[model samples]
Target: MKTLQVDLGQRSYPIYIGSRLLEQADLLTRHIRSKQVLIVTNETVAPLYLQQVLDNLSDFVVETVILPDGEQYKTLDYLNRIFDTLLTHKFSRNASLIALGGGVIGDMGGFAAACYQRGIPFIQIPTTLLAQVDSSVGGKTGVNHPLGKNMIGAFYQPQCVIADMSVLSTLDDRQLSAGIAEVIKYGLIREPDFFAWLEDNLESLLDRDVEALAHAVERSCRNKAEVVAADEKEADVRATLNLGHTFGHAIETGMGYGSYLHGEAVAIGTCQAADLSRRKGWLTDADVERIIRLFKRARLPVEPPAALDANRFIELMAVDKKNVDGNIRLILLKSIGEATLPVGVEKALLVATLNGYGRKG
Candidate 1:
């Protein structure tokens, strides 16, 4: 297993990546606070890998809660189910919660772990590529409010993150591409060289070349860990992580959640931001072309979803957690490997990009 440490002082933890890491007891034994464990997963993943995880913990008492699949279920109602299960089992503060699926599972389970008895230790066993690279780290846990995406989360950190790459084998092609969008983001915001590598190795990534996937996942996590360690609460430097999120969350919420994968929505949002940046002189047309080219190669939709009207898009963007005062701020490209959050970006330019709608990536 390849381990990456997120050094957040006392809250620091390790993200373990590899095949069959889920079945390794030492991965959990070293981090877990107690023996009473609850493995929270969705219906889609519970049947596939839950038992394998259970077999490894033959020594510890285990309970399983299977939530129905999809982003729509990532709500307080679902979180209540975890609490209800814990209460039923008489679980205490010493017990641990295991997030055993993709991003939704990790977010929801992490949120539940954060709030229960004020807070309890939780482990992120992220199964999807998107989860492995983004949501599973940083401990930004919360259930989405009807009003906005992740509008009600806390800056709570997790005990550890177990990213078992073996889980990617079950994902569909669309799901695979969604994960690549974030992989591409790490390259876009911080490491230009990784972006260049992605441009050169797009086909290898699509083909599941093990070395390429490992490099992509490792570098993305390393970049994120450094960022999260610096700004756990997203005060300044950390906000850069929202590269495509402001527009992406609006797209997901404006139309409806689960209509598009989180990473897929971000891909379109990243493209829209690229266009806006080019118009504002922050990025060149060539830069836009290169970004869209890499996204196209990954099979992600570089075009915005049709349902997000300009006014509604702006409205959603207005309430973004990243916005300061009334002006919208965005992580725009200075170039492929570098990005910046320029405040007070003109609304007209944003509208133009949104209206560009079907522009080919």
Candidate 2:
């Protein structure tokens, strides 16, 4: 097992990445603060790996809450279900909640743990690549609001994150592809060499080569851990992590949730960011083309959905949490590996990019 630490002083925790980690009870139980445990998962994942995790926590007084799976289910009503279960079982703040599925489960479960009794400990057992690489690491937890994605959330870090690469074998191609979007984002926003490596080894990634996937997860997590350690609250550098999130959240909220996977929206959003950057004369046409082509190679959408036009995008994006003082702040790339959050982008330029980039103009 390879361990990477997210150094947040007292809040610090190690991310354990390897194959068949779910079976390691010591790795999990050591992080639990009390005798009680809540394993929160979705319907799809419960059948496959839930029993195994329960078996590992055999000694703990454990309860399970299986939520209906999907991004649309990430709402206050469903979040309350976790609280309902915790209360019904009389779980205390000493008890630790285990998020046992993908990003949605991790987000909702972590949020539940965060708000329950003001705060409680939670561990992330992220099953999907997207969750393993991004959501499960950063301490950003919340359910989606109708107007925005991840708008109602808190920055509550997990006790530890367990990413079992073996579980990835069962994931469908679409889900696997979704994870690669975040991996690509790490490269686009920070590591140019990682981006080039992805350009070269993307085929290996698509094929699910064990080494390639492990490297991707470790590298992505390393980058994320460093950023989180530096700017835990997104006060500064951490905002770069949302490179494509502004436009991506607009797509998600406009589509009424779950219409497009978060990573899918991000892939399209990154393309939009690249286009806007190109418009600013920061990136050459070839640079933008390379970005789009890499996303296409990863089998991600390189264009925004047709249903939401430029005007709708503007309305949905106006409420983004990253906006400062009513002015929208965006993570725009100066080059492939460098990003900056520039404020007060002219509305006409943004509208033109949104309308022209992916639409049938």
RMSD of each candidate relative to the true structure: 1.5, 0.9
Put down candidate 2 lDDT per residue, 1-361, tens digits, no spaces. 8998989999999999898898899999999989999999999999999999999988899999999989999999999999999999999989999999999999999999999998999999999999999998889999987767787989998999999999999998999999999999999999999999999999999998878898999999999999889999888899999998899999888887888898999999999999999988899999999999999999998889899998889888889888877778788999999888545688888998998998885
lDDT of 2: 0.92
Pairs of residues clashing in candidate 2: none
Off by over 4 Å in 2: none
After superposition, the stretches of candidate 1 with alpha carbons farther than 4 Å from their true spots are 357-361
Best by TM-score: 2
TM-scores for all predictions? 0.97, 0.98
For model 2 the TM-score comes to 0.98
Task: Report the lDDT tens digits of candidate 1 across residue range 1-361.
Answer: 7989999999998898887787787887777777789999999998899888888777777888899998899999999999999889988998999999999999999999899898999998888899999997788888888889887777778888988777888887898899999999999999999988888988987887767777889999999999999888888888888888888999899878889899999998999888888887978888899888889889988887666678888998998876778678888888887888545677788888877745445
Alpha-carbon lDDT, every model: 0.87, 0.92
